[model samples]
Target: MIRQRITATTDPAAVHPGLAEHQSDMIRRCPYLGPSVDRGLTVWSAYDAEPGDQPGLFALLVETAEELRTARRESGPLACRNIAILDPEDSESARKIMQWPAWLARNLYAPVQLMVGRFWTGVELDDSKGRAMMPPPVSFFSLRNAIPSKDGLFLSEKLPEIMAILEQGPGDDGRDVFAEPLGRRVDDPASVYRELKGLFPPPSLATAG
Candidate 1:
């Protein structure tokens, strides 16, 4: 079984940014285009930060949360941003994350997969497809690739592949996505994972199937 706990709330401004405060905004909040069905944008931090009054990166996550109001309105495809924090314990990942800013500073065409990774959110299936299908909410996946549309974020090595899967429907999503988990199971920070519940995509093909 997985262990989970929520230590209470803290002010957003004071929580440590975790990343060096040099590049980009340490904290960010985008207005909800419309009503939220409970879960809005989920920002995940690795084991290093816990969401509680003690003060850590999660305080910034809490501040990012917005009040869910109003009924849903029909809208076009969403283009939300994904900013995932790496587990400080993984030295390799940590080094890469730290180097990302410097890499971009010199050459805007920096490879994004080397540093930042976004968790799987889920597939969007309209009414005919049976609403939206998702995995157990307590999932934080590692997505490798660059966000082509943003700034100098040209589509790097892994993104075009990822985009193909994203654009394709489930049955046609390709065999790569159906493969088993890439690495050993890493238990996500249960408390925060729970907080962002019901918002993750299926982890494997079996579940997605």
Candidate 2:
């Protein structure tokens, strides 16, 4: 499985190196995610100013690329999973909040699989504005019990379908799932910058230095 975490820190190059090393060591010690595979999971860290913009919130990105490669070498059907760990300090609703408009427009649609963890249970968002107003820690633990069993169709069947939706490439159906305005056109960087400036003003000159 590919498991990852998302963070909102400004400097991933500095923070990720240490965190990745620690996580790698942890995975090496883990019984389930370790022995089943050779080498270890690939780890990557990325930063986005708009999403979960806070330091100390770490995201781990894990992929099954190596396992897939090994499976092909052994002439076996690919069997792996991708999982992303979202820090509770980071908001889940905020992750895809921008996609809400396109989802409503029917220009694009996709399912996101979430492993209910301590982070999910504490989610408290205002239904009216879709804003998270409170921090709920227990919400994460509740998800542990709610997750579908590994033997069930939920993970095998539903997960693949959801992945397909997420895999839709850019320009498919004149839509970019990762696009800020969802289905709308603002393809060029200049246009994107202009749009973003309206929503988020440029950092003051005093703060720039």
Best by TM-score: 1
What tens digits encode model 1's per-residue C-alpha lDDT throughout 124-164? Answer: 22222234332212212221123234312222233343334
Number of clashes in model 2?
22
* Model 2 residue 23 lDDT score: 34
lDDT of 2 by residue, 1-209 (tens): 21224433322233334443433443444343343334323223332223332111111110122233343345322222222233323554433322221122111223222222122323444322233344432111110111223313432442343334334422123223225443464333322332332443322212110
TM-score for each predicted model, relative to the true structure: 0.27, 0.25
Worst 10-residue lDDT window for candidate 2 reads: 138-147
Task: Kindly provide the TM-score of model 1 when superposed on the true structure, using C-alpha atoms.
Answer: 0.27
